[model samples]
Target: MKLKRTIIISIFFVLMLCGSVLASPSSNNAKRINSTYISATTEETNIRYINDKFEVAPDKQWTIKFNKEVNPLAINTENVQVLDSKGQAVNITLGLSSDGKHVSINPPASKYISGETYSLIIKKSLSNKLNETLPKEVRMKFTIMKDNSNDTGNNVNPVLYEARQGLDKIYNLVKTDKERALVSALRDGVNTKINNPSATIDVNPLKDQYGNLSSDEKSDFKNAILSNFSIGALFEIKSIFE
Candidate 1:
């Protein structure tokens, strides 16, 4: 009977451990952001403000914090976007923080025009690591303050920027820790090869890494990052692989 009781207790402890590991998503993972983090003074349902105002710097980079860890793979142009008044998609950069709870939306290298209004949109498709999506879409409109002197814009090479963004995408979207580490190591090597005339990187490892990715992931990588590269950039990247 003592042995039977011991066996039952062990089973109970094992179940408890499993329950904790596979627990349901947090209730706080709901679609809304805490006003304390963003300072949304207005009572608007979807519209929010920063510092009780709708005016922002021309080179503003908005940081959004969430209650749950977001899925890096889900961060993309389709999920988060900035639109000009003409309904055109602006060239914005989206970066997921190391903790995965924050996303930084960076404006174009040329910066937003002073006195122009732009809308920041976070769609419902934006999801957390558990695949729980935002309950609704989020939109915020802010105008660039009319002050040309404060503009700190830089002339970033578009091709270089796109290539770096591609590397980031691959790093984020990879599933395994081994793949992520490989990408992390390759990033600086690839950047050095691109910027320094005397530097070179072994593309065989990258080619092997790409070959190891699942077909779906490879397709996503090509569509999301590679398809946007310019012909010259594509050739350069292809040459590296060869």
Candidate 2:
């Protein structure tokens, strides 16, 4: 009976030791989490102020160039949130690159407050995916000076811009997805003219009166849209300057 009791006690001790060893690694290798990390990967990631240019025309729409090339996927952004210093939300979300190798933060004019330095916060972002916690923040400062164009406006009529940008690219063959989407979207305007007797469309943007874009061009435009920010899906409607 004593030998049997000793054997049981030995097993219990072994089980306890195994449990302790299992818990130790988890406590050691747990993810690191903290606030106060800066969002910028490089020290050069500074916000250049175009206030002087826009000051003349406050009412008109404008664009500010970050010149900061951000790789969204490399950041491993689990969820991205942009905020002002007061902690108000800026209307922009995180968008991933087609290859998932990069990331970009998209913000419209509505979210930006003139003369304010906004803070961008990112959480659950790591150098790799499946990471637990790697967060960061960056403060961007800029002020909206008044716009001074004769009709300086942020609201872009993309149809006009499309004509200007597409001027050089001849309608060879709608060989790309980028070309196709552009053709498809412009076709919406085209069909309008077809059904309505009075409706007239300037067919210049639609690739010489024919609405067609190849799969290859469509792929190019997909990248272009990210960098160009074709939110309205109209190239001409996008603002050139702030």
Model number with the top lDDT: 1
lDDT of 1 at 159: 41
**Cα error, candidate 2, residue 159 (Å):** 42
Over 4 Å off, model 2: 1-78, 109-111, 124-127, 130-242
Expressed as tens digits, the lDDT of each residue in 109-167 for candidate 1 is 99997545577888889999999998667766654544424324632233433444455
- State candidate 1's TM-score: 0.42
Best prediction by TM-score: 1
Off by over 4 Å in 1: 1-52, 148-242
Lowest-lDDT window of 10 residues in candidate 1? 20-29
In model 1, residue pairs whose N, Cα or C atoms come closer than 3 Å (at least 3 residues apart or on different chains), thus clashing, are none
